[model samples]
Every structure is written in structure tokens, then in C-alpha cells.
Target chain A: MNWKPDKNKPICPQLCEHMSVLIASGEYNPHDKLPSVRDMAISAGVNPNTVQRAYETLEQQGLIYTMRGSGRFVAEDVSVSKQSVKTLRFEKTEEYFSQMEALGFSKDDTKNYVKEW
Target chain B: MSELLRCEKLTKCYGTKTALDEIDLCLESGKIIGLLGPNGSGKTTLIKLINGLLTPTSGSITVCSEKPGPKSRVNVAYLPDNSYLNNWMTVKKIVDYFKDFYEDFREDLAYEMFERLGITPETRLKSLSKGNKEKVCLILVMSRNAKLYVLDEPIAGVDPAARDYVISTIINNYNPDATVLISTHLISDIEQVLDEVVFINNGHIVLQKTVDQIREENGKSVDDLFREVFRW
Candidate 1:
């Protein structure tokens, strides 16, 4: 999938979100070792620090685990990550809903647009 | 990370024209910083002062706590905007030159990068294309395990196809402890690789922010903000 985020969004969080989405979609299976931070940064065309931040976020959210002297890996049971992805989806939807609401769309109007969508 | 570079009220003037105004900037190790500004906004002057190529008209700049000179030169690797090597020399000879002058020069790594870039050691500087010359310069600079690396307009003339190769070479080769200070006016092409960015205008620093902070607070890419900041 395309990896474009909002033009100016911080690359770290965007990467975190992207990884979580991938996990939610089962692209990265349980226990899969994610690419090293430096490698991901190179492929993603971003700073290694940014990739490190994304990995930290993933760890904090319990989506990934780190083995000392080894590397980061997907959690053995990503159900927690799956749950959090639901939360993230809700948050993003809420954000979009608010924007549409501010543009004078009612809830039913949005529902109709979603039906059409 | 320790402080790798520092400048306090650094200024440079040529005759009556001020190239750099009083600029106070500090950079710590392990960061990739962009010294961004439009043409003639003093990016080159600032880089020159740090590399000891030009003496500051006023104020001072330091690398690893010492003023830029023979001592600082040991800890700093500089990639100038223009080709500085003798055109008559082969790339291999220039590599030897760096090895002789810099104890930290990693000949093995230079040779490895040379092989990967398909740059033959036998190629003379005069025989190389403009882009190849720039690549050779970068490889030579990266061969050093210096505390600070100063690169001036490293990608200005590179075509889009070769820019990524250049950027990746920069990322892959640097010592983890070193700081890279790249000066350029083009933001979009290199913003992703930058940890922090220093914005300069008319010789004055307008802003110095992490690429993340700039995105979070302004909700705009550095390129967009640069357009707004320097817009006529």
C-alpha cells in the first residue's frame, strides 16, 4: 500500500501508524522480526531517529517487542495490537467526522455519504 | 550525544558586504542537520568558517571544543561545494592523499563504497563527469571517522535519479557518533533525512527546529514552510 501521510505529519508517528495498520492487516505475522531501524529508515527515505521513534511507539503500544542485543519483533499475540488498531481507526474516523461536521454535515448526512462511499 | 559543533555570534564579511551575520548555532553529535537557506544567504560562508577555509570576520566557531584549524581539521571532514582535488590525480591517488593526511580515514570503507558506486580507482578526476566528481568527494569525506562532517550543497547539481543514490550513500557510510551538517536551499529533496533544520535568511537565522517539531506544530512540511518563510 502507498505510504503517504499528510504532507507535513511527523514521519515517526506516521510510520508507527503504518506499521500498526500492517499488523492489523496481518502483513506482519506474530513473532516476525521487523526490519532494523536503520534499514527501515533507508527504505522509507527518512531519518533513522524517526524510525527509532516509530519503533519506540510500537513497543509502548505493545505492538512490538525487543530482544536485548537482537532486534524488534512483532508481539507473539497481536490481539492487543488488533484492539488498538480498532481504537486508532475510531480516532481517525472521529477526526474526519469532526471535520465534516464543521463543514455543516449532519450525522445522518454523513451516514448517507458513508453509504454512498 | 556530545556537542560536535558550536558557533557563537559567528559572522563573516567580504569587504563591505556581510556574508553571515551574528549566528549562534550549536549542533550535537549523531544528528543530520540541514543548514537551509536560499542562494547567498550565507550557507557556504558558515560552512567555510567551520571548515577553517575562511576566517570569520567576527565571532567564532568551534568543532569538538577547539577553534577550526589544524586541530579541528583532524576531527572534521569537509565536502566543499566545488571540486577541490587536482584534476590530474586519479581517484585512487586522492584516496591515498586523504589516508596520508587523516589518521581516521578508513581506506577499506572508501574502497568498498567505490566498488559499490562503480567508480574505478583508476579514473582520473578530469575524466569523471560532474556528478561522479561529487560522488567521489562524498566517498572521500565519508571515509573519515570524524566527529563532524560538513557538506556544502552536496546534491545541488544531482539529477533526481542520482539524488537518492547520493542520499543513501550518505546514510550508510557515516560513523554513528558523527554529526552531519549539510547546507542546501532545496528542502523537499532532503527533508526526510534531516533530524533538525536551521533556516537562514539574509545572513540571519530565522528558525532552528527538528523536522518532527516543525511538522507537529505547523502541520506543514518543511518545504511548504520554507516557501512561506522565504516567499517574496
Candidate 2:
């Protein structure tokens, strides 16, 4: 995947978000094996330590898990992926609403615009 | 055992000029640390002292818990800023030389990188372009499974494409048990791969923090912070 993590923000959170998006989108299926930390770091052009931190965050969130000696894998539960999708949708919708408010558009106007679209 | 390198009040001077002032630094293993600063800021002086090329005027510097002598030197692989190889030596001969000089050198790994770079072993150093020569040096250094890898400006003086190649080579060859110390002035290009950064100025360290800490505390990338810290 083409990873463009923001330079001004902490890299771990960004990596976590990107990987979560991948899982929610089914690009990384529920049982798919995740790339090794070194491989991920090389692909994203990031430090291995940062990638390790991101993986730990994902594991804690139940989006991924480690199997001893076999490396990390996406959680096998389909509900986990669905939950990620719901959370992502809410985050993006909230972000859109905030931006609209900043631009002087009311919440009702945003809902109307989305409904009309 | 985790402390790969440490400098206790290390000082270096040349005649009447002090190149490196009293400096104390500690580096742990499994890290890619950026030794960042402006030119003539004593980065090279500190690297030389660590490599045992120059004796410190005062204080002590240790690599792998031993002074910078033969014992420590064996475990440290240094890639200087400029070319230090003989021009007439072919890539093949250079590989042989490195294998003989460094016990930890991996000839197979070096040749593997050469094949990927499309560089032939028959090609002499003088015939290759500057960027390719630098790449060869990096390959040789990385091929060594040393405890500490000291790279001096590995990304500088190369085209953008070559810069990417250099960074990828570093990432691919990284040993989690060893610490890699890279000295560079171009912070933005190499910021993503650094676990921590050491900001040096006027022969003294001004800041030492993890990349995440810098971003979280300052709300800016290491590159932006470097600009602000070293701005005239």
C-alpha cells in the first residue's frame, strides 16, 4: 500500500489508522497475516520501532493479534472488522461536520446537502 | 548490555580550535538515531572519536562498553562522508578486501545487493558514478553485521532517487540488536526512519529526544523543529 503518513504528527497513531482502514476495507481480510515489522517499515519508509508501536496499538484495539512464533494476524472475528468500519465512518462524518461548521454551514444544512446528493 | 554507545564529557580539539566541546551522550541498541546538525558543527569530529580515528583531548568515549580501540573497532562499521576507497579497485576486489579486513563482513550479502543495484563486479570504482560509488560503500558497510553502524551523511550529495535507494538499503539491512547512528544535515528526508534524534550545535548537544516525543510535545516534525532550533 502507498503510505503517506503525516510528517507533523506522531507516526504511530497514523500507522494505526492506516492499518485499521486497510482491515475495515477488507484489503487485509479478517484472517490475513500482517506484514512483519521490518517489511512494514521498509514499505512505509518509517522506523521499525514506530511500526512495532502501531502493531501493539492495533493488537490492543482487537483489530490484530499475535500468534506465538507465527507473527501478527488480523483478528478472525468478522465483528471486529465491522466495528472498525463503524468507528471509521463516525470519525470521518464528525470531521466533515466540523469542517462544515468552520465554513459557516449549519448542521441542518450539511444533512440537507448530504440528503440531496 | 543494551547501551551500545556512550560518550562521557568527550572533547576534541585541533591546535587552537575545539572541534567538539564537552559532550555526554548515550545510545541504546535496536535504534536508528539521527545525529543532526548544521555543517562544521562537530558531527564528524564526534564520529571520528567514536571510530577511534582521533584521540579525544579530554574525557572518554566507549562503543560496546570498551574504549574506541581495536576491540571496539571490530564491532563498529563506519561509512565516512566522502569516498575513502582506492579508485583502481574493481567492485570484486573491494568485496574481497572488505571480507579480509572485517571478520563480520558478509560477502554474500554484498553481492546480493550488487545484483539488485545492477552493478557488475568487474566495474572499477573510478568508472562508476559518484552515487553508485556511495551505494557500494553503503552496501559494504551494511553487509557487516556489526554492533554499531556509524553512517556519516549517507543521504547527502546524492540525487533524490539515489537518496531513496540509500534509505531503503538501510531499512532492509537493519539489525534489531544493533544500533545505527546516522549523521546528516538533511533532516526531512531521513526523519521518518529515526527512532530518536540528537540535535548538536556549536560542538555541543542541544536536544536529545525520541521522534514521537518531539512530535507530541512540539506539534511538529523533527525537520521543522531542526529548522526552528538552528535558525539564524
Candidate 3:
């Protein structure tokens, strides 16, 4: 994924969301090791602390697990992660709809517009 | 979180001219912080005091619980606002000097950076251009694996490519337990990498907040907020 830290959006949440998507798509299969915090931070052009916060968020959701000092890895159970991916996709869709509505787009019109994707 | 550095009512005066007023600040470990303000806004004064170049007129400042002096200098890697290397010295000699003075200096990293910047070890400091001189200074400062890395306007007066190189070098280095205090007016260039920001104006701290908190509260970038806070 071509992801660079965007100053406009809060970096931690954006990274967390991106990692979740990758996990859900099986790009990072179950039991795969995630990039270390420092590696992710450098590649993303952000502070390691921000990356750490993002990793912690993923860990809390059970999408990733830590083996003490070894490193963080994708969770073994795929079903739980798939469910979270569904919820996250739904949340994003809702956000897009709400934004369209605020911009004067009707629900039916927004549905038709999304169909173009 | 452990307190890596702290200042209490820190005041610095230059022959009755108060450069830094009564300022109280604290920096915790494991974060990248920006010290930002306009020119003559006490940004450099604060950094200098922290580096123990200029002693405080009143109050006190400490690094790792030790007062700022030779003792604290051990843990602090400071980059001054100018080309401090002797013009007659070769770049290789300067690297050796850094290795001698700073126990944490990494020769391999210095060589790697110099290679990327096309800075030959035998090149004299006086022979290099202003931009190359700045790059050398940045390389020397970052080569040290110090606990407190204090950089002053590291990206200023340099080209965009050089700025990107310096910022990336800083972001990749430094241990998680270390704290980086960067003093610069170029907010937009460095905002994405900053975990926290301290805004100073006329020798006083106007604000200190995490980048995420500031964005959540103001719905704008730190650069916009800085302009708003310090607008004429």
C-alpha cells in the first residue's frame, strides 16, 4: 500500500485503519509478523510513538498479538478479524454518506453515485 | 512516563535584555517535540540554555535529572544554528573529532550519510557550499545515539531535497527511550513527524499540546495554528 503520513488526518488512526484493512484482505495472513514499530514509523515518516499507539490499538482489538519481546503478529483466528473488517468498512461507508448528505446529496443520489465505483 | 528534561521558571538574560522569561517546561521520553516560534522568540535561547552554552540568569534547567552543564551534555546531542566546524579541518577529521568527544557517535552511520550526500571525507569544510555544510552539521549531530537530541532549525535555509534527507535521517535514528527536541520555525515541513509541539512567543510559552490533540481540538494543522497564534 502506498501510505505516507498525512498531516491533515491524525496519523495514528490512519495507520491503524490501514493495517486493519491489510489484515482483513489477508495481505498479512494469520500468524504473519507485522513490521516493528520503528520500521513502520520510519517508512510512514512519523514518530515511533505514533506507530506504537497504532500497534497498541490493533492489539487491543485482538487483530494482532504480541509475543513478549519477539514481536507483534496477526491473530490466529481469522473470523474475528473478518468481523472487524466488516465493521470498519461499514463505518467508512457511513462517514462517506454523512459527508455527502452534508454537501446536499440525497440518499438515493449518493447510492447511485457510489455505484459508479 | 519518565521526565527526560525539565525547566522551572527558566529565565535567561543578555545584559538586561530578557531573552527567555520565567518559563516552566517538561519533556518526557519517547516523543518527538517541536520548539517553534518566530525569530527572537526565545526558541534559540531556550535551546542554548538546555545545551549549557548560556547559563540561565534565574531558575534552573535539568536533563535526565542532572543540571545542564558538562554532566548533562553527555546525554544531549546539540546542533547549533551555525556551521560550527572549523573551516580548515577536513570532513574526516571532524568525524574523528566527534567520535572522540561523543562516546555514542556512530562512525558507520556518519559514513553512510556522507556517502548519500556526496560529501567526501577529505573535503575541507571551507570548500563546501553552505547547503553541504548544513548537511555535514546535521550528520554530525544525528550520528550520536544520545538520549536528548536537540536540533536547531535543522531544515532551514536548505533545499527541499536536503530538508527531506535531514528529517528522514532523524526519524529513522534515535532510540525509543530517547527524546528529540527540535527548534524550528518551519512548522509545515516537520509537523507530520512531531508528536508534541511547544509554541513560544516573546520569551513566553504560548501553548504546548500533542499534535493529535491539537488537530482534534482545532480541526487544522499545526502550521495553520501557528500562523493564527502568532499572526501580526
Candidate 4:
């Protein structure tokens, strides 16, 4: 963790996005244990309350599940992680295509460049 | 989730100078709040009133639902802006002094931090570098398991490395059920760690809002909003 969060955006959402990317990319494998709120807070240099909020939202989203006495873990099923990856991929492609279009390159040109590379 | 501190029409005056106007505030446990303001603001006055170092000119202040006195002092750990450590005392002696004085003091935690910092217990406070001395003070304050931790400018006048150490020490040592109120004007350095921020100006509270709320509503970080709010 190199946690370089964007200061312009709210940190909780950024944390959620970061964790989601990690889970979807297999960096955090399915059923891997999530770090405790205090540990995550120290690593991220944010408040524990903020980390707790992110974890609660993550639990609600079904990306992570919490056991009564243990701790939070990534979902056991891989489909949820795969679905998130698909959404992220589409988002990244859309952003890149829009950027290329603004620079006077058509979507076809962008596709050709990728194919050429 | 209980209320840890409250101020009701709290006012403080020095001679004819009004240092703090009547201000009402409440703080709940388990929060890390930032008391942000420029110099000459009522931050110090409010902190003093909370600690019972100075009596309020009028109104009332409470900690754990009781007035600031012997009973409340036991639950509040205060790190004043100025250094209060006597230079003659060795680190070990000071540790003993604190452990004997405060019932909640944790000597083991204090020694652990000292060892991690490579500070020998036998070293005198006068021989330590300025940054190391500040760290010692902070470690002592944080070693106590108090309900409310009031730190006034804990990061001020230290090197960046020491600043990081201070911040991390705070995040690591604080009890999860307690609330911490840190007062500082250097917003950007500690903004990420703050749950809520209270902006005070000229002895009156200007605004109070959660850090995320500020970012989401104002479309800017708390540091940027602080600059905008306190800009001359």
C-alpha cells in the first residue's frame, strides 16, 4: 500500500473504490480477511471512524461479509468480484475513449491504436 | 455513542478583553475531532475552560456530563500547547512520576514507545532533542487511558518526520471508545485523520461539520475549505 487518495474527493468513497478494485483484481482474493479498522486507519492515515464507515458500506454492498466474533472478509463467491471488475473495465475504457475523442481522435482511431500496440 | 463533552453558552474573558464569546458545543465519544482556528482565536480559552484551568466567565462546560473538576479531570487527558516537563527529570523518573500520579497511566506502553524511538529511559529531558522531547510529552499524554483526549497543537513546531510520528502515535494509542479533540491551524497535515472539524474565529465558533460532509457539499477538502473560510 501506497495509499495516495485524491484530496479533492471524499475519502470514504475513495477507500471503498480502492478496496473494490483490489478485490475485483484478485489482489485481495475471495475470502481474504480485511484489515481491522484501526490497522487500516493507521496505514491510510485517516480516521478509524472513516474506515469503519467504508467497511460498513462495503458489508452492505455484499462485497464483504462480517462474522460476529471474527472480522470482515471478502465475499466467498467470485461472481460478485468478477462483475465489479467488468464494470470497472467498462468505466476505464469509456474514460479513455472520451479523452481520446476530446483530443480529436475518433473511437475507431483509438481502437486501431490499441490494436497496433 | 454517549456525549463526552458539552459547552453551553460558554464565555471566557480576560480583564476587559473577551477571549471567548458564548459558544454552545457538544462532542460524542469515539470521534476524532479537529478544533481548527487561527491564532488569537478562542481555541486555547475553550481548552482551558474544559480542563478547569480557568473558570468560565459565564455559562457552563461539562466533561462526561460533569463539570470540569477533580472527577472530570480523571477522564480527560490534556496536552497543553506549551511543554510542562521539568528538564531535570530523567525519562524513567518522569515515567514513574506519571504512573504514580495518574491512575490510568500505562507505564508499559510508555516504555514500549520509548524503546521504539530509541530513547533510553535514563536520558535526561534536557539532553533530548526538541523533537524527541515533544514526542516524550505526547507519549506520556497518550499513555493514559482517558475518556477524552484534548491535545492543543500537538503537531506544531516539529519537523515533518516528528509530525508523522505524532500523528501515528495518536492513531495507534487512542482507545477506540474515547474521543480525541486536536486543536491546530495546520489543517492539511491532519485533515485526513479528522472525523469532524470545528472552525473558530475571534472567540466564536464559525462552523462545525464532518470532514466528509465538507468535502461532499463544498466539493473541496477540509484544508481548502479552511483556507477559504479563514482567508484574510
| lDDT (Cα atoms) of all candidates against the true structure | 0.87, 0.92, 0.88, 0.90
Candidate 1 whole-model C-alpha lDDT, 0 to 1? 0.87
The C-alpha stretches of model 1 lying farther than 4 A from their native spots are: A91-117
Please give me the DockQ of candidate 1 compared with the native complex.
0.68
| Candidate 1 residue lDDT tens string, A15-94 | 88889889988999988989987788778888888888889989988889999989999997777768868989899899
DockQ of each: 0.68, 0.82, 0.59, 0.78
Backbone clashes in model 4, listed as residue pairs: none
- What TM-score would candidate 3 get against the native? 0.90
Give the Cα-based TM-score of candidate 1 against the true structure: 0.91
Task: Label model 2 with its docking quality class.
Answer: high
RMSD of each: 2.5, 1.9, 2.4, 2.0
Over the stretch B29-124, how does candidate 1's per-residue lDDT look in tens digits?
Answer: 888999999998888888878888899998978889999899999999899889887999998899999999999999999989888878888988
Top of the candidates by TM-score: 2
In order, what are the TM-scores of chain A for the candidates? 0.79, 0.81, 0.76, 0.85
- Sorted on TM-score, best first, the list reads 2, 4, 1, 3
Better of 3 and 4 by DockQ: 4
Q: Model 4 chain A, poorest ten-residue lDDT window? A: A76-85
Model 3 lDDT tens row, A44-111: 77778888898999888888999998999999876766786798889889999999999999999999
